[model samples]
Target: MALSLSARLPSCSSSVFEKAHKLTTQPPILPFPSNLAACGCTLLPASMGVARRRRQVVGAVEEQHNQTSVLAPKQSPSYSSSKLVLVIGASGGVGQLVVASLLSRNIKTRLLLRDPSKAISLFGLQDENTLEVREGDTRNQNDLDPTIFDGVTHIICCTGTTAFPSKRWDGDNTPERVDWEGIRNLVLALPPTLERLVLVSSIGVTKYNVLPWSIMNLFGVLKFKKMGEDFVRSSVVPFTIIRAGRLTDGPYTSYDLNTLLKATAGKRRAVILSQGDKLVGEVSRLVVAEACIQALDLECTKRKIYEINSVEI
Candidate 1:
């Protein structure tokens, strides 16, 4: 399954996966970042493969986004009726997969996205009962109306942006805003009755100033992400943060339809979930997604934080 994630991540799409920063004053030699969140996974419709076709150009290359059109279409995911999951950033790599996985499980899901129309193209049309789309941006508190959270039992916030500057930041959606402001607003907007909020954060969030992570933190993504995690921890909402390593799976949005349908978790099927930020290797989007869903039901995961990575072994 490890191989499955890496194998799928090569389609060459950019990450709008958001990150954040917060320079602490205590015992500060360099800015000490906070606890974390990060990337996610891909699960095709449990019955069908899956569909999220978007054309994107990354690093001077335009991926063949429609190659999958020639292939057979995948079915929507299945989820449970007893639970309602509100998925923020439902259009991202991890977010897309999380939605796909939820659908496969037959769970009722509501997606909060900038463009509600993308839902049709990404996850495919669904019964209003199974999937609902709300138009909103996390950065704006005005967009997060209280009614949106009314029936939401749980939430999976996979929202994020690239660590460095990219087109995804066109709207001034920087880590400071998306990671910090966006998350803070979302956390505050969440109903006190919420059962769980699974936050996907990056691995380096806890050590943005240390070595390699510092490189990625040149943009303060790790630090800002830490701030976002802090908000969730401080909020009354019960939550779990899943920090992912340098992501290495297809932004599947960039791959040919054929590849997505055939893609499966490779050798890296087993997952390693450590409480401290000790694991520093890459993780599969699959593992990340699985961890998010699993945490929703695991009592021990409540109010806890973990870093997730997957391996071939």
Candidate 2:
């Protein structure tokens, strides 16, 4: 029952990951910087057990990357040989970053997309073992065949649409369909042994009927998203729900996987994590992407719902 609230964040940066690595390797004593201290922010320390688990997770990725780098210096390194991650909505803003990060870590990834050709255009060609693409629509239960979940130990679902009507809703992909029904269908079809399901949700769901949130929920997006979250919670599958703020940063729709891998957070390098859904602001798609990847292996994140946001240092 871990719940959290966070503010908006900028894009992703390698420094962020580097700092995270350092946190795991060193003693878990994180002190707020002078600027953050002036803002009256506080930092929390992870228990030794959590630190060890974090270290193992980060160490494994680095070790795998080192080994693969030596063998294939010219190609992207494949690090995690045991985990197969299935990413839904891999073509979207956050989803693209998630896939790029996963591939960069050398983790095996499978994508469920309506147009398989998009995978080719965005990610370019790849070894089937490293990046596999499957054509399917979550709105259709039949589209979520059992085979689609084969070998998929983890799932990061970033499927979403605009709060208001737009071209994305062309195929009856409304909030009711995409957010609620789509999520319900996917959850029902998931394999019983799936390790985790990280769902990207919106922040105002709990108070969708209240003022500003009500305005955004004009078309029921927040309401449907809450429904989706509830369904996932009721299931027995291990899950982590990341409630994001108004998303900022690029959708990076036109960028290729290489460009995506190099994406940065610019000035937004600081992240804030908290409990309760009390914060509200925009968040970088990159930050959300990184959060999903990190949550996959962090034991503390299991069966928890966290709201993530970022601020300038």
Candidate 3:
């Protein structure tokens, strides 16, 4: 869980930026202010200036769309009162951060991983009051402890393996196992009361082809991921599917958040950029965690699939 917080800064390089440029998709709708910083990303609204600016920009976009983007009301039903969230695959970069961010907000978190002890050293999480780690895996439904989901309101699946392995070897089979069937198994294992599920998925999975690229390429990835996405979409449960841009262990930087959602409202993509893999600016895993948490509480985020990448801040 602490590993999630460890990624917080920026560095700059043209090659990295070029890779970033090629990797980035169309931007989010509202252009984020240039002055915004990615540091302290999870708790931005604590600053009235940032909160005010966010409201103004979101309001502008909504007005332009002739549609409303409503957050759960101030008197919204206290789903947070459920107190616990079960984050599957919580040993990974995104899942670990999801756990940390939830715990940082004083929310109870039950992290499920294949090996809890392994994650202990990897995540550097020693905070007993804020976190709990359990041994489990998506492939083995029987391994999950039902008590973990007793009063849980939301679930996040960060189950897929990082794609670098596939890139390194044409014979790799991790993606098919982890991203495809593994997702189906996770879905089958969910509790009926679980209200929200957010999946961290990659962009271009729907585009890349398998010929020159390996069978594990994004296109190949998309072929399997799309199956999983479709399964989630068609399930009785509500869900949010996130197609993320290039991932980096980079520093936190300002990024415009949503694009497909913007385009659906008749707007073009807004160009956004975070510091690429360096300390100047980047997308913090912590921010992504918070965004997923907030998504569970917002009507605007329900039953929707959105994309996130660096945007002009």
Local lDDT at 110 for model 2: 98
Give the lDDT ranking, best first: 2, 1, 3
Considering summed lDDT, which 10 consecutive residues are worst modelled in model 2?
1-10
lDDT (10s digit) by residue, model 3, range 1-313: 1111211212223212223234444223112233222121111211124335455445334423442211101222222344677788675555655654564456777778776775455445456655677776665557665775767778888776656554523434366676777788777767898888888765555544733334447435656776787788778777876665554432122111111011110121122233211111234343454446655654445676655543221
**Candidate with maximal lDDT:** 2
TM-scores of all predicted structures: 0.73, 0.76, 0.60
Report the CA-based lDDT of candidate 1 relative to the real structure: 0.64
lDDT value for model 2: 0.70
lDDT against the true structure, each candidate: 0.64, 0.70, 0.50
- Between 1 and 2, whose lDDT is larger? 2
Q: Per TM-score, what order, best first?
A: 2, 1, 3
TM-score of 3: 0.60
Clashes of each: 44, 7, 22
Q: Which stretches of candidate 3 lie over 4 Å from their true place?
A: 1-81, 122-129, 164-173, 210-219, 250-286, 311-313
In model 2, pairs of residues that clash are 7-309, 8-282, 8-310, 9-310, 11-265, 78-106, 79-106
